[model samples]
Target: MDMASALASLSRLQHPFSRQRSGWLLAGTLALGAIPALAQSTSGVDGVWSGTAQSNGQQVPLKLEIHGEGDHLQAALLNGKQRSASSSGSYTDGHLALQFDYYANSIDASLKDGTLTGTFSSRGRSIPFTAQRNTKAEPSSPNPVNIGGDWEVEVKSSKNESAWTLHVKQSGPNVEAVIQRIDGDTGSLFGEWRNGQYEVSHFTAAGPSYAVLRPQADGTLQLVTPAHGGTTQTWTARRPQQARAAGLASPDDPLQHTRLSNPSQPLAFSGKTLDGKTISNTDPDFKGKVVIVSIGGSWCPNCHDEAPLLESLYRKYHDRGLDIVELSFEEENQLANPTRLRAMIQQLGLTYQVLLTGTPDQLNEKITGVEHLDSWPTTFFIGRDGRVKAIHTGFAGPATGDAHRDLEKETDALVKKLLS
Candidate 1:
């Protein structure tokens, strides 16, 4: 059977959570309306529904675009340029449901008098959600200020203090923004300048994320981002050089953050494939081949982004002695069913060998060869001689623009070097 067909078969394999389906991999589109990459609000219960999910008492901006009506509905969650359409959708009795099967995540709410009130839920965690028709936005500023360029952002919460790079490209009122950290970026966030502040949002099968920014008098930007757990975080951002000059650290290079404990030692690891077959480095498929071993989970968004690239690379170089293996560390429930992992493999058309390891928390403990293995999508390159060559700790996805391209190019070059 074809990949999609196989995925569909696996999806049909029932689970305890009836609402949990591989929504990201399902293929059904409804042309209810058009929500451009950069968009404003529209009227009715079907168009673009915009609002905030309560975050630690703060609000994070989000946009839900729904088209069609009744039993046949097309819906997508919008966050800047990142638009994730529902794999499954329904509308009945003034109630709407959109499920992104990939993460077993769903959004269910009731529509009343042009308003939507409900909750976005995953596993056992639920976040209160409420939105109204995204009304047409009118720029309050006669001259929309330019908040373009690279910004050095600093998050100041009692729990976490980290530095991030914020990239923004603006043309008049439209804006495209993202935050790049040591591990990966937050994907694309598209918004327009409205009122006196800037608002951007992104939602996918992974969940919802929204940020609001206002320029301050001291030439800095006050950033408020609503995150999971119903809590919002306020941060400050300035130019890259300025932040660095003020002692704000830069993001660690992806290739330099994670490394092998012994460069000359061969990576000794093995895990069980879906069907319960154990594959190891000594396997014939891996012996004398240049292998790329990726450590990540199906629930991770960055891993979702990196899977396609890994698949593409494998297809391109597999005949030339390139071998790729993915060690998936998923939730315990997934270990039993693996519907999401199956969907990802089918959606990406990955032909590489995939094995089920433990969970994400078991990463460091399960793999004894590496240090600083904190990132979800770390990649290890093994040379033909069976020695470790290089390790990349994080993923720079397409949403990162040039950085992502550069990483791909660098990887290709490194693989070529290892093969030679």
Candidate 2:
């Protein structure tokens, strides 16, 4: 892949934001009458399922929550505790197919008796999986040690080392965890204390996701996660206080990571809306308006997390002379059809204009007046003066705990300042 596509492909690897979600839980089996078209064929396969995908020899668990009417289907691959997803599909014959529309991935499964066998496929890679109807049972007893709290985690990757915040919450034997950077976090890792280690599992519609946490005698955590090429990455965790006193540095400030080529000038770019109308800072709708320019993609997980936050801001400030425009990059298929993009806007109840900027490979060539875009979901705050006021790279959504809230407050304050 070229630089732009590589950046886009790899940008939101560990990013997640949160919204109030009425989760689709695995609840036994769906009765024969649940879906009209599949009533006869999908009787025992219509409800929630416990599934695992086998990549190499590693198994990653996920919850498949299926509920729909007629031939249409709305499915959720519940990865860990929080999955920023949007889905659609159909159930025909004994075959079931689910598309993570925005994420640009899908699952094709077939049911035999109560067992479900399928392949979760994305972007040319496919992992085979097997699932079975769930039995709703409470979690087992708590772990011998509660590894619940925030800690400073240092990840040692093959190419580099980076700092991350490990947020873990445990209930009985059920444990939920996510690794956070200043930008955001990995969506969620939910599992239980199994054997001698805490096995936290995650399965995004794309890529590998699983982590094993072992509590050491020193009251810290040792995490081992699978990486590219069957290699494993190791992480050491320590309390923030301990990390701070030991003089470990944190991730860089997001606001400082990206900047404009010239702050005195407006962002120099135009994009075609989903309907093919070009819009830019020079447009009248943005004239004298405190505008927010968001750079993202429908196929991005972090971008999915950041959309609602932008929508909330736009809804609150649009009438007060604020306008938010999303310049969304996408895959070739979405760039051509944009069906999923429209579905996403409707699914999220977004009213702001989303422009189809270009394919991921065209990102750098399409945008101007920016030094560089460090990550997906980057935002530029422009004042009514038509000058760039601030540029915040990446998102610190609810996944970052206090940092997300803090960023929201800061964003509100900045918008208020720019509007004033």
Candidate 3:
């Protein structure tokens, strides 16, 4: 899909949490509906089972690591580098259920004819999933291709061009990789090397995605990623020695230009806090203070990843002229928006002020006077003089390791310079 279509998909189906208790109850009901007839047998269900979950005609690669015996069971969902552990799970009789406390979601399935079939339910949506245990071990390659190294990758499509770091490690036929982008690491891509091709896939709360890497004759890795909307984009990655350096962009980089028509003009906005108290750009807390206007929503995984760092920044500099105002573009329902924000705040222990900024388009119009909002978790740094100083388009959360560290260092330096 194009960037616009991807953004539309994000804004429409971003919120994964149910606003009402009844919705969660309904999710539980739907989860249990998979097992109508119970047969007692737990054999052949152990070990790592991998498969795909289908939702809205999109297939998400899923890996479930199930362990323990009887009612006391453990399960972990692996999507890229994102791993969610279920606090409680049970494989009793022919029924299987795993509850993820973090997402208020559950996966319920039943074993039948050497295959487990069920649905993954969260919020109000259910995705059908099936998994089969690997009966045959993958044969080790006679001459394993060593693709283990750091690489600079550039992905170009009709919509946009972006740079990233590809970190790959291989042991025998097992290959593990992480794609470090400006926003964050693409979770963990865990797969195996077979023949001359390396294929990996991950399924996260956002959706399911996969990448195929083929080693070219010239030693460059060619990557193909399929979008949920049926569009495929190709990327090329080469080792740092052979590739041009496409280092992560700093906040002050000239290439990091603002799209706003009048950036020097102090951004104007008016919204209510989660408590319904009115707030504006001209509020006393922001006067003469270096403010960071954070544009994000509770429904975004990247936003969730960015929240803790923002909270730490607030705690470190709030008294020293640093103020953060989170303008949340949330679900359409007015009541659900605040509730979601509250949950997010409580979960992250955020002390900064959060306001309801409507949908993504509404936030774009309100802040930049434009109709196009490109990415979630975009942050605008406003100097003490009240003019916009820098605009950060996306967040690279801690999962990116050193990439995230570089972002923190640059952000801290800029904030300090503005404070001075």
Q: How close is each model in CA RMSD to the real structure?
A: 7.1, 9.1, 10.3
Question: Per-residue lDDT for 112-194 in model 3, tens only?
Answer: 98888998876567779988764333464567677877877765422143556787777776666666554334545656676
Candidates ranked, most accurate by lDDT first = 1, 2, 3
lDDT of residue 297 for candidate 1: 76
List the pairs of residues colliding in candidate 3: 80-187, 80-188, 81-187, 81-188, 183-396
lDDT of candidates 1 onward, in order: 0.70, 0.68, 0.63
lDDT (Cα, tens digit) per residue for candidate 2, span 387-412: 88888877765656677788889999
- Using lDDT as the measure, name the better of candidate 2 and candidate 3: 2
Q: List runs of model 2 lying over 4 Å from the truth.
A: 1-42, 67-74, 79-87, 135-143, 155-161, 204-208
Give candidate 1's root-mean-square deviation (CA, Å).
Answer: 7.1
Comparison by lDDT, 1 against 2, better one: 1
Our tally of clashes for model 3 stands at 5
Q: After superposition, how far is residue 366 of candidate 1 from its true place, in Å?
A: 0.6
